[model samples]
Target: MNIASKIFNSHSKEDGDFFLAMTRILGFKPRKLGVYKKAFLHRSVNKRDKKGNPLNYERLEFLGDAMLGTIISKHLYTEVPAGDEGYLTKMRSKIVSRKHLNELGKDLNLIEHVESKIPKAHFGDNIHGNVFEALIGAIYLDRGYTYCEKFIHDRVIVPYVDIEQLEGKVISYKSLVIEWCQKQKYSFEYEVYEDTGNDPVKHFGVKLYINGKVMAKARATSKKKAEEKASKRAFYALQDRISKN
Candidate 1:
């Protein structure tokens, strides 16, 4: 009933700090702190349970991803009664897009609580989204689906879901180019190779070919990013014709 009682009931001072941190983030006290604790644990620590099974946030991330998709789907279904299947699916993808999730995680400063042996700066951008999803997983485990849904609605949808703005958002330019190529009955290819540039990070170079003609070229730190960058350039180059589709 009281703060001291709540702390004594679950865990001591450490959990006390976690409790306050979670309260600030979730606007409510967590019933079970174990799940929440595991949610932020990175695999680098190599911890195992009594049964020798590995412990980390990855499994929780999977559960939270499913939960997030379900809640977002429900909201989209209710908000746009006239939306067809394709429209609704696209809308949901935009809402749960990795870029948006990363932004949400950063807003909550979720990384500050992560228990990783590696320096926080070295962690990839996806860490933010991963921990956020893990947090959702913990909420579901601790409080069940109702609370999980409430948390998503309160923290995610209510503040951020603007249907009009999201409709125009670009989740992946590569997908757009492929879709256009398909509709036009044109063949396309992405030739990716290791970048020879002097950049410190290993870079990838991509050349986008549409109808057997080189349309655009780009380089990035990853093949996917390089391809996407090339595709984005290709999209703009053919925007006039593509928009007619």
Candidate 2:
């Protein structure tokens, strides 16, 4: 073979190996391997292309996010024809919530292929979902929308999207409580303060108030968690009214 052909062959073989590895994870052969590689590459690697632009999965993640939103929105629109804009949007958000996506990534063990300088253990739970989204982004870029949609259907919708179950799934209790309060024209606030108690870890306490009435109280390691816990309690307390509305 000529020099150029020999080099091409070597590169192709390497790409083939990557494709095989991804196939084992994805349960199907990918039409384009470059996207999967980009998905797994962590920003810490500091890789750059010949054009001097930094190369990582962040850009792909953005694309993947858009694609996922579009597909889920379409699914919701068709499945729940009676749902208005707000209802559909909230349903879509729940499906693509960070917690749900993180769980999906963990279930697939997508982090196993991440190329990062940092130790894997040091990485937070969000990394798995981030990589998974980046992979979707890559798939869209390499194989076009059709293949990307197919991959999402196979990996996400088929396995996870249950319309009835999702309707009751609470993506964010705090957000829900806040929305309900606003809709009902009730003043609501989450009072968060440093919690110094006998505990191994630092904690924050939250008191949820609705129209000057204390609805619920809770504590957690972080302000967000504290708020969520408080909101969850508030939800249960006002479950009857919330359900009616």
Candidate 3:
């Protein structure tokens, strides 16, 4: 029997909805509803299995991450015969970047099915990516590697993994800025300060300084994001110098 046939034989409306949703996303039936359920379960629910193992998607997320990396690696190895280890690694990073995964989840509307105690609006951007990874893990566990591979190939690889475009994609602007500064032997610093936004959400401001010169400034909901934003601005400011090196 398929996932819905064996696992979702009940008359619960929620189960029916979940079955249909999984079918739409996976382009096939899911074997174990409970397995996929745990994929979306938040730790805040405080549930546990018969063996007393914690019930949450974290472990599944780890497995999915590994699967994504392994499958992407194989594709890169075959497609880019000229790529060295470092080049292939970088390309894979670009394809599976957090931002890209978050986009994928958003495209699939995965967050709508998340069962969490916290309000959906309160969740961070990474929640989308986390569930996406967890879904991959659930697929692996439900039907094994072949189905897992097919799901990734259809949902992730075919639609988004473009080597030619990815070559120019910069996953992290902050990393690029730091690399450029290091290569050119220029000292740089990201000076952070309290953000003055009146919004309820916390914010941070950062100023990117290169050789005692203020290159760019930006503000965001988190320090890392603020720094990255500042670095992006700094990159454009020094694009010519950075690109040549």
Best by TM-score: 1
Model 2 misplacement above 4 A: 1-9, 12-15, 169-245
> Tens-digit lDDT track for model 2 on 80-176?
9999999999989988999988977876678877889999999999997888888888878877888778888877887567676578767778888
1-245: candidate 1 lDDT, tens digit per residue: 99846796767788888887887788778878889989999999888999999999999999999999999999999999999999999989988889989977876788989999999999999999999999999999999999999999987997568685577777678999999999999999999999857543356899999999999999865677678779878988898665787
Which residue segments of model 3 deviate by more than 4 Å?
Answer: 1-11, 169-245
- Of the candidates shown, which would achieve the greatest lDDT relative to the real structure? 1
In model 3, the Cα lDDT at residue 244 comes to 85
Candidate 1 weakest ten by summed lDDT: 195-204
Alpha-carbon TM-score of each model against the true structure: 0.67, 0.63, 0.66
What lDDT score belongs to each candidate, Candidate 1 first?
A: 0.87, 0.81, 0.84
Question: How many pairs collide in each candidate, listed in order?
Answer: 0, 0, 2
Q: Identify the superior model by TM-score, candidate 1 or candidate 3.
A: 1
Tens-place lDDT digits, model 3, residues 1-245: 65455444755767878887877777887778788888888887888999999999999999999998899899999999999999999989988999999977776778888888888999999988999999999999999999988989987887567575588666778998999899989999999998856533356899999999999999865687688778878988797765788
Quality of model 3 by C-alpha lDDT? 0.84
Candidate 1: pairs in clash: none
Model 1 / residue 145 / CA error / Å: 1.0
Reference-based TM-score, model 3: 0.66
